[model samples]
Structures are given as structure tokens and as C-alpha cells.
Target: MRMGLVYGCAAEDMVTGLTIQCKRWKPVYYNPTKSAFLGVSPTTLDQHLVQYKRWSEGLFQIFLSKYCPKIYGHGKISFGAQIGYCLFLLWAPVALPTLYYVVIPALSLLHGVPLFPKVFGLWFLPYAYAFFAKTAYCLIEDLSSGNTLNGWWNSQRMWVIR
Candidate 1:
């Protein structure tokens, strides 16, 4: 079935909804790589922020309104794929995890709180190493793949919009 299409900076909600609906009802295989690739505009940073804000607000509105993947996604998708999509949805708004996992722990040490205890403290070494390693890996992957600028731009666009 051919679905009527809709998309714009302000139309993410509709686009997102249509995608889920199509995925739910259509038996045809859907390849995300074959989906639309947009070329966003805004020569100035201020204008970029304006567009970003509009898109972010729309996405957040979708998330809040039960059109999100986890809610409407249901049996239309596999559980693991649904979880992955949900994580993507949460990536923008879950800033507190960054603060909780990274910032608060560092600040606590500065305040003379015992950063770790005697027995389980050793876990911190592995945890910190894993965190750093994952971060470095992502950075290296982005740079090596020549996605650095694009990744940074998308991140910047999402940051303020979230």
C-alpha cells in the first residue's frame, strides 16, 4: 500500500507516526537505508538552532503523546529492535545520565567522599576503563570514517533541540 508522505522540520511527528503505522500494517520489507535522506538548511548558527528547536519540540511531543516506538511499535517490530529504537528516542532527553554517571561521581570525590570502598572498589577500574574505551572507540570510529563533522553537527543539532 502506498502511504501518503509528509516531512519537514516541523513534521517529524507525522513522519514518525507514518513510519510506525506503515511498519505495523505493511508486509513489504522496509529498509531504513532506503528511506529519505534530508538536507537541512540554515547558513547561520542562530537559524540552525531555530530549526533544531522546532524539530526537537516535535519529537518530544511525539514521545510524550504515546506515538513513540515503545507504545505504538507493539508487535509491528521485534522486541530488540524496538528497544534499540526506544534508546534512540531517549538519547536526547536523558542528560541526567551523563551527569549521574560521570559528573556527580567526579564531584563526589572532590568533596572527600570515598570514591570507592575496600572490596568492590576494584570494579571502578574496569568501569572507568570501559567508559573511556567506549568513548575513545566511538571518537576514533567517527574520525576514521570521516563522519566527525557530520556526527558533531547532528549532535549539536540534537543537544539544543532536546
Candidate 2:
């Protein structure tokens, strides 16, 4: 199980790197007008990006078992990054309120930790929002979404409302 997770994480990283590479080179890619100066054409550049994106996104997905240490520890990279990222983002929406509103009384009266009401109060809303937002976007892209830029931008939009 451990080795399998590691290999999957590595594969996820490679795919992610490939996507980044394609995105990085997007502007520099040949265009008929621009490439004519050198010797290539836009079609070739488009084709190249298409190939790279196809290979990467065709199998694209994040790994969560991303284990590194500081970088992190043994874990699934895709699952770890996406869901984990959601964890923190969702956390932000609640952390402040929990501290001021619930943590103190709960910790003092209950065990060493915040009470269920305190924890639950902070947990559900942000979590549900993040989950739906991320899931909808992921599912939409996985099936059919030719506008890669839009897909990427929308996914990013999850972090910020605007």
C-alpha cells in the first residue's frame, strides 16, 4: 500500500510538472505570423501544446498521499494537496470564529479539545462549500471542457470569491 501510494504520487507530480511546462511555454509557442520569422508555424506550436496537454491531463489528478517532510511526509500527493488545500482554505473561514467564540469554553469544560458544538459549528459550512465548489469544477473538467484556461481559472477562483 505504501509503495503503491508513493509511485502514484510520483506519477501525479510528473503529470503536474508536464501541465506546468505546457502552460509556461504557451505564449512562446509558434504562431504563423511570429514563427514565419524563425521558420515554424502556429499550427505546429498548437499541435505541440495539444500533445503535451493531452498526455498530462488525460491522466491528470492530484495525489493526496504526498509525503515529503517539511516538504511533508509519506502520503498521497494529489489527495493531500487538493483536499488538504481545501482543508486549510476551509479552515481560514472558521479559525477566527472558533478561537473567539467556541474554543475557550469547550476546552475548559470538556476534554483538552474544543467541544463538539464548537468544532462542528466551524467545520460544516466552509467544508460543504469547498467540497461542492471543488467537486463541481473537477467533475466538469474531467468530462468535457475545452477551455483549459477557463477551467484553470475557475478552479483557482475557488480560493477567492471574486
Candidate 3:
């Protein structure tokens, strides 16, 4: 990890770097750091949009690159941890497919059409529940960590952009 500084949008590249290091050699003791003095500087909505775009784009770039989690991260970490980390890493790219699915239901509603044939049998329910469950889990974690209303609101806004 010390060979290079992998800092970029949302720190996705940094995560890859650290994961690779961990795969090669486990740390005897790992200390995750936080800063009480650190805070995000408030900016205009346009600036926030630009920042989000940059972050997602950076993550997407990493996803497309040779350093992708599946390519370099699979055997390095525990299987479950690797899967979870890859899912998190792929979040931004997955947003496009998620948007398509959501928009179809929205468009069907707008057009006053049935969501699907009654016999179609809610096949998407499990997937929807998984998404919701993950979201709720993250929100609960954030709240338990003393997140403020502004922090929650900001995170929601960023999620929408994603």
C-alpha cells in the first residue's frame, strides 16, 4: 500500500490498493483512522453534482481497469469479504441498471398501466427487499454512529445522484 497513494473519487482506488496489500500479506494489527477535525465544506448544488459525477466516474474507471476487485481482489481476501467489497465497489456502475428497472415501473405508473400481469407473480420482490434491506442497514449504521440530519440528507442526495 505504501508503494503508491491511491486517492481518488470516493476512495475506491485506495480500497483496491489496500485490499491488494492485505491479500499479499495480512497486517499484524490494523488501525482504521478517523479525524474529529475533518468535515465536508458545504457547496452549491451544482458543485455537489460535479463532485458526485467525478466520484462515480472515478469508481467506474476503476471498475473498467485491470485493478477491478474480481480480477485482483478475489483470492486475496476472504471469499465473503471479497464478495461484499466487490458489491460495494460496483455500486456506482450498478446504478444504471437499477435506474432502468425503476424507470420502467415509474413509466408504467405514469401511463396508467398495470405493473405486470397479475400472474407474473412479483418475481422482483426478493431483489427489491435485498436493496431495501441493505439501504436500511447502512442508514441504521450511520445513525448509530451519530449522524446528524444534515449528514443523512446529504447522503440521500448523493445516493440519488448515484
Q: Which candidate number has the best lDDT?
A: 3
Per-model TM-score versus the true fold: 0.54, 0.21, 0.63
Q: If the candidates were sorted by their lDDT against the true structure, best first, what order would they fall in? A: 3, 1, 2
Q: How many backbone clashes does candidate 3 have?
A: 0
How many angstroms is residue 142 displaced in model 3 relative to the true structure, after the best TM-score fit?
1.4
Over 1-162, each residue of candidate 3 has an lDDT whose tens digit, in order, gives 444445554666556465556557544444346646466854777888777667666766666666666776766666776566567667677878988988999999999998854544687677677888987887888888778767887888767755
Candidate 3 vs. true structure, TM-score: 0.63
- Count of steric clashes across candidates, in order: 0, 24, 0
Arranged by TM-score with the best first, the candidates are 3, 1, 2
Candidate 1 TM-score, true structure as reference: 0.54
In the range 1-162, model 2's lDDT, one tens digit per residue, is 111112343245443443433233222333354334465532454575555444333333332233222133224334444444434323334446656655577666776663434435776677678878987777677446444666566546532421
Better of 1 and 2 by lDDT: 1
lDDT of every model, 2 decimals:
0.63, 0.44, 0.68
RMSD of each: 6.0, 16.7, 5.1
